[model samples]
Target chain A: MIELSPILVTLKLATITTLILLLIGTPLAWWLSNTSSKSKVVIESIVALPLVLPPTVLGFYLLLALSPDGFIGHLWFYISDTPLSFSFSGLVIGSVIYSMPFVVQPLQASFDMVGKPLQQAANTLGANSFDTFKNIVLPLSKRGFLVAITLGFAHTIGEFGVVLMIGGNIPEVTQVLSIIIYDHVEVLEYTQAHYYSIGLLVFSFIVLLVTYSFNRKLMVRL
Target chain B: MIEVNYKYKLNNFLLDVSFTMPENGITVLFGPSGSGKTSVLNLMSGLGNDKNKENNSKFILNDRVIDDSVNGLKLEPWFRNIAYVFQDHRLFPHMTTSQNILFGFNRCHSELKPEVLIEKFKIKELLGHYPEQLSGGQKQRVSMVRALLSQPDLLILDEPLASLDYTSRQELLPFIECIHKELDIPMIYVSHDIKEVLRLADYIIIMDKGKIVDQGDIADLCISQPLLTQQEGASFILDARVTKIIEEDKLVELDCGETILITAESMRLNDKIRVLIHARDVSLCLSPPQDSSILNCVPICIDEIQTDENGKLRVIAKIGEQTIVSLISHRSARQLNINKGKQMYAQFKATAMIK
Candidate 1:
């Protein structure tokens, strides 16, 4: 029988990583879309580095940054007395870095598509910037949010190299589906690997299918 | 009074404009495209960040200094209480018509009720419908109601009727007039269309290449500014009062200095109206013709005569204190022997448009 602990850990990591990305990526994406500052390009390039850079490159830096003696790890150790290098929380940080572009690019594009005319109209009608974004921009970017959430969750589930480097094969903790599949292949258990791989494939396809169909209905209404 | 002084540097143009408008009635910002007409409206409403902060711009509306770069005072648009009606009718697509109208009314402490504006603009039936479900005319009507219900100190209309067809524009003009008449809120309307300007403007500020070329009362500016009269080679406005209405002929007799008959069916007796007479429509005669088909033949004394371009003579005259301009070819001027101080009859078919 297939061990279900790895599958559960993967789902939990993906869920937690997506929640953090949405919380931070929203304001970052809004700033990227609306700001005319000179540093916009620098911020945009850093956010998009995950899409082009190899996962091992990001994982290597994250490993150093989350070590007990490193800046972030020292703070975490002082606060919780738990090492962050190989913990579940460390895997979350690595996954967020690896999936930054997946969440931000779509949100930024949607915010840009909302345009400035409607915002100006809202302002002249006595709505402030925050109010305009909440009422006008957020409602109009529903499809973009759907695409971003689906891509972020799917990208986190499919992570392999970053998870291997940062989350070292701790059963029921950080041994996600991809890492467990790698373990099965190393031990020459092709049947176990096939079970997890097929599961992921079906899950991703169903998620994307639902999102695209729902997005089409939204476009019709718009 | 609304006093504005702004200087902004665009990509390839520099806009420098300063003028004061009346505290009441419609003040029109008239110019061609790229003339910075919309820029003035944007700066006044604080809708766009096009103001050059370093260049010392000052915007004072009824003694409140809304923007003064020298003092580092620029209020945010929401705090300024200015309403804008854009050309595209920027209603919220996610909200229904009623929600869009109340988006402003609910946000501000407004005394004007939404029901009154809804009934006036005739958008009550469209309340439950989305913006996309309404026609272009209906959408514009809803936007106007939305702007009015905000209880803005001043309303800025940036060519609100520009996107509609001629028939829809004609249908919507009466509602715009009612905003000025019933609500009595000051409005700054921007348009390049001369017909729209003549129909609505109480004060006119003519702009060209981002500068104020001329500005005055519409009656005075129509005779002094050639741009206002270029469509008909020179026209004049007569502010008259309706003295009699002949229901059988669908005509109304107006008295300026003398009684003038115009084809108007809706005007009641004793109503004040303004008649725009194209200079080309008026003909000069040595005496009033007895059997002419023209309905108006008022005696006017020639005050001045100037040669216009293309061998045309613009004959400026007066009927009491009201000014009338007539454009005739040099040949006709010589044939009629018209000169300064000559007492002549100006005959034309007049059309009265209610102000």
Candidate 2:
């Protein structure tokens, strides 16, 4: 029988990573869409680096960065007195970094589509910056948020290289569905590997189908 | 008074303009396209700024200094309490017409009721509909009501009717007039169409190449400026009151410093109107014609005579205190012996453009 701990841990990591990325990516996407500053290109290139860079390259850096003697892990040691490597928190950090562009790019495109004319109209109507963003920008970017949440959650669940390098594969903690499938394939247990792999494939298909249908309904109403 | 002085450098030209408008009437920024008319509106509303130029501009509305470069005082657009109606009718697509109209009212802290403006603009039926569901004219009307309900200290309309069909424009003019008549707020309207300018403007500021060419009362400016009269060669406007209507002849008698007869229908007595007569249509006769098909023959004294560009003589004359222009060839002036202080009968077929 397949253990359920890896499935639960995978869902929890995907959920937590998506939530954290949403909070961090919103303002960053808004700034990218509206700013004319010179550093805009620099910020955009950095955000998109994960899409083109090799997964092993990113995993190597994350491994060094989260070790007990490294920069982030040294800071965490002073606060939590627990090492970051092989911990669930380490896996979450890895997933968030690997899945950032999935959340930010769609949001930036949607914000750009809204454009500046509507915002200026809102400002002349006595809505300040924050008020305009909430009432005008947020409501108009509903499709962007939906796409970002789906892509970010799915990307984290399928993470392999970054989670392997940093999570250290501890059962009931850092060992997730993808890592369990990898272990079964390595031991020549083809039947067990098929179980988790098929489940993920069907889950991803249903999620995308639901999202597209919901987006179509929204388009008709708008 | 609304005083404005702004200087900015565009990519191809420089805009240096300064003018003051009255505090109670429609002051039209009239000019051709690319003349910086929209830039003036944008600067006053604080919707845009020129970063390449020096920041020594001054904008004051009704004794409140909203922008002063020397004092470093620049208020944000929301704090300025100025409403703007754009040419495209930029309503929020996500909100219904009622919600869009109330977007400003809820934030402005003003006591003006949305129901009153909704009824006045005749947009009550559209309250439940989205912007895309409304027609172009309906969208513009909703935008106007949205701007009005804000209770702004000033309103800026940037060619609000430029994008509509002729019938829709005709339908929207009455609502604009009602706003001027009901609300006491000052407005700066921009338009390149001469008919819109003549019908709506009480004061006019003509611009050319980002500079103020001329400005004054609409009646005085329309007659004196060649730019305004270039299209038809020296047209003049007469502010007249209807004294009598002859229904059988389809004519109306107007007292424009003299009894002037015009071919018109559906006019009531004691109604005020404006008559626009082209100078080329007027012919001067030394004696009043005893039997002529032309009806209007008012006796006017020549005030001045100037040579026009195309070998024509423009005769500036007066019927009582009202000014009239007659464009005649130099040979006709010589034949009629028309000089300053000479008395003659000016005859034309006057068209009544009722305001």
Candidate 3:
């Protein structure tokens, strides 16, 4: 029978990583879109580092940072007495960083496209920044949010190098689908590897297909 | 009065303008394309950032301080309650017409009824349509309604007719006039078009090269300052009261120091109006020609003879207390022996613009 623990762990990790990325990415994206500061390009390049740098390089640095004696890990050890390296939480942090650009770029582009003219118009109409963002900017960037969520979730689910380096193989904890598939292949169990590999392939394809088709219809309507 | 004193620095121009406008009626910021007219409007409404905090600026609206750089206090745009009607409409594209108009009203929690302006602006049918679905004129009408429904203390219209075709501009003029008649809110209208300035200005603030060239009452400025009329050549405003309506001739007789007749159909007896007469239309003669086909001859004693910017001699004259200007050739001025305090009959056609 096909096991469910690895599959559940992968979904859980992907969901948590996407949610955390969204929480931080939104304001960062808004700032990137509106500001003309000198450090804007620097921040943009830093956020986009994940798209170009190998995931193993990022994962290696994260693993070192989350070690028992490392600064972040030492703080966590003092607070909770649990090591961060090879933990599900550590994997979550890694995935969030790895998926940062996927979530931010789309949102920044859409916010930039909505532009300052509309915001200025709203301001004169007695709507403050938050109100205008909620009513005007948010509604207009619906497609951006959808695309960002899909790409972030799917990217994390398909992660291999970063998860292997940071999460390690801990059953029912961080032995996610990508790691399990790697295990099955190493042991020459092609059937088990096929089960997870085919599943992920189909899932990623369906998620992207739905997002793209939905965006097209929305584009036409708008 | 709404007083403004600001020194804003743009890329190529350092704007230094100081002017006061009446709390009511349309105050026009009239100037050419790159004269920092829109820049003034933006700064006055607090829609623009000063960038240079050291530059002192003060804006007082009827005793309430809106912007004071000395105190380092500048009210945000929303806090100022000044609505802006942009030339591009700037309507929320995602919303229907109904939603867009109600967006401001609901946000401001205005006590004014939207339906009144809805019916007045004639946008009731367009309530279900989006801004992209409407025509250029229709979009502007909706934007005007949106701005008015916000219940703002002040409204700024920045060249509302600049983006429209000639026919659409003509079509939208009456709605603009309707706003002046129906609302008591103070408005600052910016336009380079002299026609709009003449038709709508109660107070005029003329700008050129980031400086206030002149500012005063429109009727007073029309004759006193050549900057006001230099666009459409030279023109003058004459204060007159309608004395008679000749139905057969479709003309109205005005008592302006001297009697003048103009072809205005909808005029009543004793109705006070201002007549806009172009100086080019007036011809000077030594004596009043009674048998000529041209109508309305008024005797004007030349106040001064000055050369306008175009190398044309402009004879400034007065009839009673009101002034009338005439653009005559040097040969005609000499032929008529026009000199300071010289009495001459200024004859013109009956197509005077009575407003």
Candidate 4:
């Protein structure tokens, strides 16, 4: 039988991960766009690492880091007195790393595309750095933000290998839609797997359809 | 007075210069391409100083310190209250003309009315349109209004007309002149165009090879530095007032030291203007000739004569209090017996270049 908890958990995880990515990713993306430091290439490569690295390899490191005695889990245990492994917070951390490039790359490209000339022009006209970025840069980078948000949310929803490695398969806690599909296929429950699979397919298509149609309007305005 | 001193080093080019400009009127920063004119303006405005923190630079305007590297006191660009009009007219693409002009004015607490500049720059009808919808000249005009509404203490124009076509440039010059005539704001105008320098400059600063070469008043420098008149090799400037207009002949009479007539249109009486006369155009004669086709001749006494390296002699003379120069060959100088204190008539065609 089909269950509702996996879909709800998947949506919740994707929403929280996307929100966290945007919070940290904006300044990181902006720095990568404008910085000329020699370390820029190194940081960029690290951010882009997830695109090529297998999810199992990334999950292995994350699992070790989130264990009761590991670096991240030790800190959380000191604060909350609870183990981080097999917890929703730990799933969030893993998803943030897995979805980072999807959010940051688009934002960086958009920031670079905004260029320096208009920013300099704004500076001459008595707009401070923050004021210029808020009024000029942010408004011009609308398409970038849209793409980053959509990709970040969708990629987190589709993640399977990393969740399986760290989530401990705890239903209504760490079990997400993709992990449930894997569990169903393993037990030969083809009907249940087909439902969630087709659901995600339609949902991703609708999200992209809304974004691209909105993008066309923005292009005409420009 | 405004003082600027910078020991700037960029790549292989090093520019170490110190100079003071008058606190009022337009000071033209004239130089050839790649002579660091724009760099100097950027320093004065406190922009593009990111990589040059180690170098010493100081900019003081009217006794207020704007930038002092020694003290580590550098005012940011937004706090400087110095508006800049770039050659490309960098108006924000996302903004309408009204919003772009208001960007600066709203940020600062200034009493300058935007409507006055709007009407003066003729951008009232264009306020609703975005910059992309406007023509090149129209975009430049809107940008000028945008800068002026800020009510800057000093304005910097970096070849504001350089990007426009001939007709657009001609159309924009009068608006720039209108700004000079109406506003008392001191301006630093940068250009490689000499005609622009002659028309707008109250003081001139010339730069070459990342250093200031010569600096003076426009009329004085035109004679003292012959190379400034790059096209004709030598020229002179006359500040004259229109005394009469002969509409039938399509001529306007100008009273400098001597009254001269030139074919001009849309001139009004008592209108003050600058006239540029090429040294090669003026001919010397022992006396004024009535049978000659030239319609303008003025009596003058030669003050100085020098032979240039081009095997040509340049004669400097005075018309009332103003200076005029004539370029002639050694053969012609000897033939006419031209020398200092020699009284003679200077004859030239009526169609001298007048601005």
Candidate 5:
């Protein structure tokens, strides 16, 4: 039998979190960059809250929220007669929130840099708002989107406390690489922890190096 | 008709302006810097406005009252049917020239095709090139063409040539002249250069200190002594007929009521030309001098004299039915003892005359 390893679990969580962040964070980033509301500070603070808050704190909130009697969990229970707590889906939700900033900040900065003239010119040329975004905004922000997805996927792979708090190290379902490493260290499995730590360190370093190198190359070309 | 009235205050630079123009021909917003020329264009285009106000400013097109504060009427920039040629000529950096031009025309119903305009504006060679590859003049030309392709009712240009070099400015002038002649859309051309205004503007609006100081025909400003007295750099344009050309001497004689000889390139024998003679180019002599290269000497009576903005006296002279504007040093005025009713010879260069 194949040992459903920590590496496989980490990969699954990263992929799921990256996909969810892409779907949800893109519109949020676009709105944050374009809208001129007075509540911009509040909205920005909320999106960026995960960056400063401890992962355990965020996870604790999610754990409470996803329990059977908790607000979101009760709604889920009413819909499906089961809470998302201790489930793979709960871990995915926690990872998505934890990695949202990695997906959104790059996109916001890129959208802001693109300026209004191109969009204004397109509008005067009779393209509606949606058409303008599709043709102009999306194409121009292609590099930013690439950076966002890469950072988000890599960021979710490193999550520890958030996944542990919500998913509770359930084998085959919630025991990701971070939890496996924590379990190894707690049981004094020094060799396995060292191997997993080196693997994660190398993987994260490669992802970040690629991001910086690609960003520098793009800046020079642009 | 097109009418605009708006007031905006930003960081203590208050811009209060109002103007009305017919819905055809070019109406130039001629002014010096800090005169709020571009601010007026922005107001018309609905680009820059304080968010606090509802932007009740009115812009009327063809008497439809496109914007009216009292009636709570306002149209979005797309529906307003106004096209702006910015000074920087903000072409999309990512698109080719053809794509940029076509983007606007794809929405326009006008019979003016992109191919025809590209050929007419001589941007055919630049169709596949990106905007960064084009020179400043080429970009401005494309900008005008792009705005035209949008088929706007009002074409607004905000100092489009001010950023280009002299040669590029010269290269772009003919295309602007072509558009001025070929198109029926009303244009609001903004420029600080007096020469450009004289060349293209049919109706001139002189802006100063955020106010419409004067608005009239260029000919009227050229002939008015009171207006000339107020101008810091007053010059005159003459409606002259080329009576004869001395091909032997490479000189053309223009009959500006009296004969004014100008050294110019070859032209038709009897072509009517408009000559611009700067006030600084003219000197006063009590009597016509001999053996001087100043060939365009005309005997004239000083009709009026007044001190201008720089505290220098400008003398208005009348030779036959035509008036000539001259600027002389205050000491020269005293040294020559020049005043109204004094007859003096106006000596200036023939080359200074621009046809």
Candidate 6:
């Protein structure tokens, strides 16, 4: 029987994380775009912290929190004995945290570009807030949302250190392509490592190419 | 009635303005640049609450308290039953003409169909077009219709025609005039153009440097103080009885009071038409020249002389109760020794009068 490929785990984690991020990020970005709240700066600073912080620092905190008898682990234990760490779910949580800025900032910037005048005009026209956002703001800022999604997907696929801290190597579960390639190198299996490493290089390049090209077309249309 | 009493300071300009406008006709707020005309429109529209709050004023509309500093009553813009037609014609670029019109309807009572308005505004054919596709006049027409479709209690036209070209303005003026005459809603029209004010306003409010310099009926204000000098320079409403059309000279003869003055351009023999008389066009002559270039010289008494801000002399004359203005140099004022109780001939430069 053929062995299950290790890369499938990373793909699943990236896809799920991207979907979750889009759901939460769209509204957060919309709020950041339209809100007059004085606390916007504070929220913005927090969203941006993940972008600039060392990946290992985030991994260290998440690892401690998700370990058995830890903050999230103990709470999760009340529901079930199984802790979140060293599982597929743990990698998803880590991926989402690591890839958040990629999803949110683009959406916020796009929403900002949509501006207040059009929304106010929409409101004056008898549309409540939801209708205004759906009809006016959404249509206007679609390109920004697309950019956010592309960046989010790409960023999630590239996560390594955070996933490593929470998700210990477990083939078909948590042993993703990056960790698999590392394991291959540690075992002096250079050929297998070369295969996985080359695959990642090509994948990231293609994703980036798609994003930049789409952005170029958007700029041209604008 | 709409009453505004507000005082605010912006940069070096202090805006202290108050006026009570009639509820049923077009009340024009006329002023020069920096006269705070736009500010008044903004305040009335709720787009200017911050400034209005800073100034601490009151705005009452139709006995409904809109902005009252004492009571702390300030309504949101959407709640105000006043539709503002801005000078820029802020049509949503992403929206079609029909969509824009529909937007206005959405803000208003849902009882009326928006298509009825589209038919009324004569924009049915242009509904599918975006704002960028329409001409300036068409866009303005669309904007005006949009404002009206909202079914506002009072329409606010903030220089709606200010951005259009001359021909476009001419095209749109009749629609505005018709709206004022035929529509049920009252309107507050703001403009600095005196000609527009004269043409469209039923009641005029004159402003200068953030103050109400004068306010009254257009015809009465034309004949009254301060405003008269400016009007005189370009103000003559001649009730010309067309005795006969002199086709040879292409001139119309107008009978004003006891004088039958001949104008170069003639009208149909029995038509009574109004013509404007300009003050600078009228010259003072000690005696009427028999063989001269001056066509219409009337024998009259010099009524009085008033000076402008620049101290230029404007000689007000009387040929019955009708007073005519003639601008002369201050040097001429001294040389002619022009005084109130003096008799002089009022000679006019025929071409200075425009419609």
Which stretches of model 5 miss by more than 4 angstroms? A1-8, A190-199, B9-14, B32-35, B63-65, B119-125, B165-167, B198-200, B222-233, B240-273, B285-295, B309-311, B319-322, B330-337, B342-347, B352-355
Best by TM-score: 1
Model 2 regions lying over 4 Å from their true place = B241-254, B261-295, B304-315, B326-342, B348-351
Pick by TM-score: 4 or 6, better one: 4
Winner by TM-score between candidate 4 and candidate 2: 4
All candidates: CA RMSD (Å): 1.8, 2.8, 2.3, 2.6, 3.5, 5.3
Per residue, candidate 3 scores C-alpha lDDT tens digits across A112-181 of: 9999999999999988999999999999998889888999999999999999999989999999999999
For candidate 3, list the clashing residue pairs, or say none: none
TM-score sort, best first: 1, 3, 4, 2, 5, 6
Docking class of 6: acceptable
For all candidates, what are the clash counts?
0, 0, 0, 0, 0, 7
Candidate 2 local lDDT, B1-355, one digit each (tens): 7899988776678888899999987999999999999988888888766575566689999999988888988888888889999999999999999999999898899889888889999999999999999999999999999999899999999999999999999999989888987888898999998878877888999999989999998889877777776554356788899999999988999999989898888878898877777778888999989999888899999999987777788898998899998899888988988889999999997564555
What tens-digit string does per-residue lDDT give for candidate 6 at A1-222? Answer: 123467777778888999999898898888887677899989988888878898888999999988886788778777887778888877887888888889999899988887776665554444567877887878777788888888888787777788788888888888888788888899998888888888889999988798789878866554
Q: What TM-score does chain A of each model score against the native chain A?
A: 0.98, 0.98, 0.97, 0.98, 0.93, 0.92
Better of 5 and 6 by lDDT: 5
What tens-digit string does per-residue lDDT give for candidate 3 at B103-201?
A: 889878788999899999899999999989999999999999999999988899999988999999999998998898789999999998888888888
Q: What does the lDDT read for residue B344 in candidate 6?
A: 82
lDDT tens digits, residue span A1-222, model 5: 123577888898899889889889889989999898889889889889999999889999999999987898889889887678998888888888899899989989889878787777776666777888888888788789889989899888888879878998778888888788888899998888888888889999998899888878776545
TM-score (chain B only), all candidates: 0.92, 0.84, 0.90, 0.87, 0.83, 0.71
- Tell me the TM-score of model 1: 0.96
Residue pairs in collision within model 2: none
Clashes of 2: 0
How displaced is residue B76 in candidate 6, in Å? 2.7
* True contacts reproduced, candidate 4: 0.82
Q: After superposition, how far is residue A152 of candidate 2 from its true place, in Å?
A: 1.2
Instruction: DockQ for candidate 3, please give it.
Output: 0.85
